[model samples]
Target: MKQLYYAALIYLVLGLAGGLGYREITKANGFTGDTQLAVVHTHLLVLGMLVFLVVLLLEKTFTLTDSRLFPWFFWVYNAGVVWTAAFLAINGTRTVAGEPTGAALAGMAGFGHILLTAGLVLFFVCLRSRLSTSDTAPTTTIGR
Candidate 1:
């Protein structure tokens, strides 16, 4: 839970800072030709900050840290979000600068999506186990 809180806080700061940085970069460069760089802020906010915060809340509700797969999910999801956001920022800057993009960046972004999918699947599996009706009511309080 603490790890999740820390991750959420870190991503929140990064998302806010990245949004401001990207806005300034676009303004300074007069980059209105492409919307690629514009996506960096959205991804940082949604995937980095929002997702982690939601997960932290879920952890509190579900006591998700008890699951063995949770640590894997946490790390993998964060890695995917970070990897995707980094490439988005890089590609967005390159596009704004009128630079040509290569295949490597695309490949990395695809890999990030793969990691995100795998992590999500694992998270669902862990959630399913916890949601079984056989579990004690005291431990699995839904509205508490």
Candidate 2:
């Protein structure tokens, strides 16, 4: 959990820096149009920050005993995020350069999105089930 928290914070800082640097570069080049930097920023937030936090929270809050599904979910979710972010970054670069959108790129992006969404859904369902179990107690008191 601590590692994930640190990773999320680092990613957030990096994302901000990347966004600002990209903006500066675009401005310096006098190019006012689509930029892959936007995609990079979005990916940094979605994959690095959001996904990292979610997984970290689950690990810290839930107890997995002899459950294989949790490990599978972790790998699938992280892989999906990585692939989606990479594809988006590549596509974004092409789009920013005024290049034609090829069928391969489109398909990759679509597939990546689907995988990421599916992974997120699976993780959510698992987390929800774990949270609803009678063995897990609420963190806060009702009267407090």
Candidate 3:
């Protein structure tokens, strides 16, 4: 749970930084055209920060860490988000600098998407396994 909190915090900071970096870099370079840099900021915020925060809540409710695949999901998902965002940032920077874009960046970014997909699958599988085995139904203790 704490680990999830920290991950969310880290991604929140990274996302904010990515956005600021994009703004400053583009402004400095007089770049007015669309670039992959903006996507990097969004991805870090949505997939990185928001997803982790939601996962933290799910963990509190479902104890997802108890699953064998939870650790794998955690690491792989984070790696994918970072990998994709990094390449996007690099491509954006290159675009802003008026440099030629190439196939290698696209390939690397594609792999990151694959990793994110696999991690999402793992999360669902873990959640399903837990729900299937849970004998206790959800009960309200709000008034108690």
TM-score of each: 0.86, 0.69, 0.93
Cα RMSD, each candidate: 3.3, 4.1, 2.3
Cα error of candidate 2 at position 119, Å: 1.2
- Regions of candidate 2 where Cα sits further than 4 Å from its true position: 6-10, 13-21, 24-29, 64-67, 132-144
Quality of model 3 by C-alpha lDDT = 0.91
Please give the range of 10 consecutive residues that has the lowest summed lDDT in model 1.
131-140
Poorest stretch of ten by lDDT in candidate 2:
63-72
Candidate 2 lDDT tens digits, 34-144: 755577677778787877787776676575322346656656666666677666667765666667768897788678678777767776777777766736664676886
lDDT of 3 by residue, 22-76 (tens): 9999999999999999888899999999999999988887889999999999999
Angstrom error at residue 20, model 3:
0.2
Q: What is the lDDT of residue 95 in candidate 1?
A: 79
Candidate 1, residues 1-144, lDDT tens digits: the string is 778777877887888877887888889888777655677667767877787788778777777777888888888888888888888788778877778878988888888888888888988887776665226665566897
Ranking by lDDT: 3, 1, 2
What TM value does model 2 have?
A: 0.69
Model 3 misplacement above 4 A = 136-144
Clashes of 1: 0
